[model samples]
Each structure stands twice: as C-alpha cells, then as structure tokens.
Target: MCVYLLRGIAFSKDDSIPKTGKAAIENKLLAEAVLESIIGKKGVSPGARLSLAERLSQLMKENKVEKDATKTDNQDEANDVSLGDKLAKEN
Candidate 1:
C-alpha cells in the first residue's frame, strides 16, 4: 500500500530518501510535479489526491516553521557574545 502511494507520487529512484540539499530540492520539485500530474491523471480517486495534497501542504508548513525556528536560533547565537569577548571589549 505504501509502495503504491509512493509510486503514485513519483517515479521511484535509489536516492528517494534525499540526504543532501540538492537532492532535497529536486525531491520537492518532483513532488510539485506529481501534484500537478495527479490532478489530470484519470482513474485516480479525487479523495486520494485531495488527501495526498493536504498532507503535502501540511508537511510544507511544518518544514517552514522548523526553518524559521532554526533561523531565529542562529540569529540569537549571532547576537550573543562570550564573557571573554565582553571582558576584552571592556578592557
């Protein structure tokens, strides 16, 4: 069942589980294409396509939130100074 759903999404590749930035970007593009393809593909139930699209949308939202949090953490770290640095600056 899982295999069928994945195939419906896109053609299987050895690097399906992307491990790098480029691969992740490619996978996302592929997913967008799949969503577009499914809408016109015949024989697929509307419910299935809607469910898949909704899940993808949800995942994208979650990913954005996580990225935002990471960016905020990085900004906070950048604005922080070590005690030694503070002391050196005051000296």
Candidate 2:
C-alpha cells in the first residue's frame, strides 16, 4: 500500500534549488531569493516553487501600487486643506 501511494505521486528529476549564500541571493527578485532560501534547506517540488514565486511577486507588486496610490491621495488632501491656500483664497 505504501509503495502504491508513493508511485501515485510524481517526482521531478531535480526538485532542489541551485545556488546559495548572499551571492546567489543578491541581484534577484525578492520572491525568488526568499523561495531559494527555503528550498535550499528544505525540499520543494520545482513546479510548486515556481507557482509560489509567481504569486508572491504578484502580491508584492500590488502592495507597492496600493502604497503609491495612498501617498498621492494623502498629498492631495493636504494641499486641499493647507492654511496658506485657505488664507489666500479668503484674501
């Protein structure tokens, strides 16, 4: 039964990630580096690693865009309520 169960699962020829240390981590996307760190010490299928990296990259991009939008909105709000602008308008 155990043999049958193991046979049912597909394994990759090279499930491990290559490269390590700061050199391997540097000059790469944050998501890739982070996953590489995990796969270096632990085991992860190549397909699953790729999928996780894709999702993590997407989330990071979305978070950056959201932060930029919020910053611009806050600046606009500050300008709208500025004391100088209000006093100038009244004068």
Candidate 3:
C-alpha cells in the first residue's frame, strides 16, 4: 500500500509545485529506511511492520496537505466566542 502511494506521488505529472516533488522523494527515502530497519527484526511481526509502514505513509501525505498553524489559529479565533461575551449574551 505504501509502495503504491509512493509510486503515485513520485510519478505525478505536475511538477509545477517543487515542494510536492521534494515531499515525495523524502517520503520514499524515509519509507525505504524504515523498511530496511524492520526487515530482519525479531520482535515485530510482518503484519505489524506493514501496518506501521502504511500508517507512516498516510501520515506523511496528510502532513503535506495540512494547513498552516497560523491560518488555523486565525480561523479558530474567528469562530470562538469569549466566555464574557457568552455570559453577557445569556443574561
């Protein structure tokens, strides 16, 4: 699953975004390193290792798409009502 996802990212046609290409390469290398580390481990089962790889890949993809923290904080602030304001409104 991770392999297929990585392949899709790596082979994506749109090279207009440099960051996306860099992320794909970074993820691929990280995945390779992790797989190598787990290849001969005695304690972890194969299924567990594969699950970890899949989750890691998913997380990497999600991280790439995540919004900026400052933007999210601004949105939160816009949506939030102060406790004092809420109390005054209730009265």
The CA lDDT of each predicted structure is 0.55, 0.49, 0.53
> How do the predictions measure up, each by TM-score?
0.36, 0.34, 0.28
- In the range 22-82, model 1's lDDT, one tens digit per residue, is 2222476776675565554562456546655676788889999998776644767778997
lDDT by residue for model 3 over 1-89, one digit each (tens)? Answer: 12234333222334332234344334767766655554436523465456556767889878777744335547678788989999999
RMSD for each of the candidates: 9.9, 14.0, 12.7
Instruction: Give every collision pair in model 1.
Output: none
> Which model is ahead, 1 or 3, in terms of lDDT?
1
Best by lDDT: 1
Over 3-66, each residue of candidate 2 has an lDDT whose tens digit, in order, gives 1011122223464433332333243477455545544336354555554557568888999999
Scanning candidate 2 in windows of ten residues, the lowest lDDT window is 1-10
> By TM-score, how accurate is candidate 1?
0.36
| CA deviation > 4 Å runs, candidate 2 | 1-42, 72-91
Q: Where is model 1 poorest over a 10-residue stretch in terms of lDDT?
A: 1-10
